[model samples]
Target: MKEKWRLLITEKNSAYRNMAMDRAELVSISKGNTPPTVRFFTWKPRAISIGYFQSLEDEVNLDACKNLGVDYVRRITGGGAVFHDKELTYSIVIPESHSQVSKNIMESYGRICGAIIKGLKQLEIDSSYIPINDIIADGKKISGNAQTRKAKTVLQHGTILMDVDVEEMFSLLLVPNEKIRDKMISDVKQRVTSIKHILGKDISFNQIADAMRIGFEEEFNIELNKGILTDEEIELTNKFEKEFFSTKEWNHRR
Candidate 1:
C-alpha cells in the first residue's frame, strides 16, 4: 500500500519554531492524521542546536553564544551537536508501516538520500549517497541526516550546507584544543564540501527548496500535496517551545 505524502514549507527560522514542528510531526504522524511530511526550515540569527541526548555544555561555548546572540535548542532526534547557520534544514515524518521499504536504519537513510543525490545531480555535482545518513561528492560530504522513531511514526532531519563557516563552526564547538583535533579537523575538511563551494556562486534558498521538493516526488513517484500544520499541533508546539526548547535547562543539560 502506497501512502500519500505532504510537502510543507515552514514560515520562519527560530529554533523554537523548528522544535515545535518536531513535536507536531510526532503527534500528526502517530495519529495517522497527516500524511508523511517533508518540511523545509531555517534558523534565525545563526543558532547552534544539539541533539536530545547531547549537552550543549559539553559542546558549545555558552559565553560566545550569549555574546554573539546565537540561540540554542535540543532536537528530539539523536546525533552530535550542529551549528545551524542559516542553512537549509529538512525534516520528514512518516508512519512506520510503509511497505516494500525499510525497517533497517541504513536502508531508510539510503531512501532519503536518494532524493538528495538526485537534487545534487541537477547541479552537475555527481554526488554519491553514503550509508548511515550522508551524501558525499568527491569523497566529501554535503549533507547529513538523523532519524528517530515514535510508536508508529518516524521523524528524520538533516542539514544541507549552503556556505558553512568551518572555522567559526569548529571554534564554537568544544573540540579538543590539541594537535589530534587539528588533524581531525583537516580530515573533516577533506570529506566535506558545500553547495556554495561546489558551484562557486550563491544559490537562492528558494531554488534549493524547490529542487528538494521536485527530487522527492521524482524519487517516490508519488503526488505530494502542499500542507499546513493543524491547530492542535500549534498548541502543543507553543507549549513545548515555552517549556523545553527555549529553556536553559534543556540547552545545557547533559
Candidate 2:
C-alpha cells in the first residue's frame, strides 16, 4: 500500500499570508494535528522574502519595495533573500520521525530536493541538485530552496523560477558594497536562469504544479490526496499573519 500525503495548491496570495500559512502547516503537522503536506502557492503583487537570519536594512531596499508596491516578509527558514515573482513556490512539511527524512541537514536537503530534480526532468529542463540546497540547469540556478526544523517537523520550501528579471530584483535588494553591485548583478545573471529561458517558451503554473506533483509521488512512492486546510490551520494562519508576519517586529526582527 502506498503512503498518503496531503497536497495543497493555493491561489496567489499576499506574502504575509503565504508565510503564515506555511508556518501554520508546519506547526500542525509537527504537533500531530494534521497530516504531512505538500503545498504549492504563488505571490500576488510580487514579493521579497528574506531568510530568518537576514537583516532587512543590509539585504533589502525597503524604499524600493514600498515604492514598487511589492510585499516583503521574513521566512522561518534560512537562506538568502529571494525575489518571489513569476515562479512556482512549493513547501513540504514532514515529521522528523518519518522514515524518509534524514536527521542530517545536508542529507535531508538532498532527499527533499530529489522531487524538484525529478520535476525539472519531467519538464525537460535537465536540472541537477547542487549540494546543500539549490537546483541548477545548464550550469545556472533555476531553483532556490530553504529549510527549517522545528517542533519535531521539517519545513522545506523553495522557488522554481518561471522567469527572471535580474535588474528588477537587484533594484529591490542591496549589496554590501554599492561599488560591487553591478559586478554582483553580472555574476548572478551568469549563474542564475529560469524555466522560460531554458525552454524558450512560457509554461503555465498548473503544468509546473502537475509535474512537481508527479515528481513527489514517484520519489516517495506515495499518493497525494488534494486537501483543503483544516479549520485549525486557517485560524492559526490568520493569527500569525496579523500578529507576526504583518508586523515589523517579526519581519524586521533580524
Candidate 3:
C-alpha cells in the first residue's frame, strides 16, 4: 500500500487569500494536524507576487496594477517577482524531515521539480529542470518554482503557464529604464513559453491539474487522495490573510 497524501483543488482567490492558504497549510502540516498536502490554485483578478526579500514598490508598478484592477502581494518564499495570470499554481506541504525531501536545498529543488517535469510530460511537452528552480521546454522556460522551509515543514509552490502574455506582464513590472523596456520584453518573449505556445492550442486548467496530479503521484510514489482543507486550516488562513498577507506592513516590509 502507498502512503496517502491530501490534494486540494481550491477555488481561485485573491493573492492575499492564496498566500495565506499556502502558509496555513504549511503551519498545519508542521503541527501534524493534517496530512502532507498538494494544492492546485489560481489567482483571481490576476496578481503580482514578489519574493519575500523584494521591495514591493521597486518590483511592481502599483499604479498599473490598481488601474487594471489587479492584485499584488508579497510571498513568504524567496524568488523573483511573478505575474500570476493564465497559469496553474501548485504547492506542496510536507515535513522537512520526510525521507523524500533532501537536506541540501539544491538537491531538494531538483527532487521536487522532477515532479513538475513529469507533469509537463503528461501534457506531451518535453521539459527539463534547470538548476536553482526553473523548468524549460524546447529551450524556453515553462515553469518557475520557489521554496521555503519553516517550522520543520517544506512548502514549495510554482507556476506552470497555460498561456502567457509577455506584453501585459511587462506593463505591470518595473523596468530599469523606459528605453530598455521593449528590449526586455522581447528578450522575455524569446525565453518564456506556455502550453498553448508549445501545443499550438490552449489547454484548460483542469486538464493541466489532472496531469500534474498524476505527475506528483508518480514521482513521489504515493497516492494523492483528493481532499479539502480542515476547519483549522480555514481558520488559520483567515487569520493569516487578515494579519499578514493582506497587510501593508507585511507586503511592504522590505
Highest-TM-score candidate: 3
Candidate 3 RMSD to the real structure: 0.6
Collision pairs in model 2: none
Q: Can you write out model 2's per-residue Cα lDDT over 1-254, one digit (the tens) per residue?
A: 99999999986999999999999998899889987899999999799999999998889999999999999999889899999999999999999999988889898898888998888888997988897689999999999999999988999999999999999999999988899989999999999999999999999999999999988888888998999999999999999999999999998898
lDDT of each: 0.79, 0.93, 0.94
What would the per-residue lDDT of candidate 1 be over residues 28-132, giving only the tens digit for each residue?
A: 778877778888888886788787898777788877887888887788888878888846888888877876248887788888888777777766677877776
CA displacement after TM-score superposition, residue 72 of candidate 3 (Å): 0.4
Show the lowest summed lDDT stretch of 10 residues, model 2: 124-133
Tell me the tens digit of each residue's lDDT in model 3 across 1-254.
99999999995999999999999999999999998899999999799999999989998999999999999999999999999999999999999999989988889889889998988899999999998899999999999999999999999999999999999999999988989999999999999999999999989989999999999999999999999999999999999999999999999998
C-alpha TM-score for every candidate = 0.92, 0.98, 0.99
Candidate order, lDDT descending: 3, 2, 1
Once fitted onto the true fold, the runs of candidate 3 whose alpha carbons sit more than 4 angstroms away are none
The best-first sequence of candidates by TM-score reads: 3, 2, 1
Query: lDDT score of model 1?
Result: 0.79
Q: Please report the TM-score between candidate 1 and the true structure.
A: 0.92
What clash count does candidate 1 reach? Answer: 1
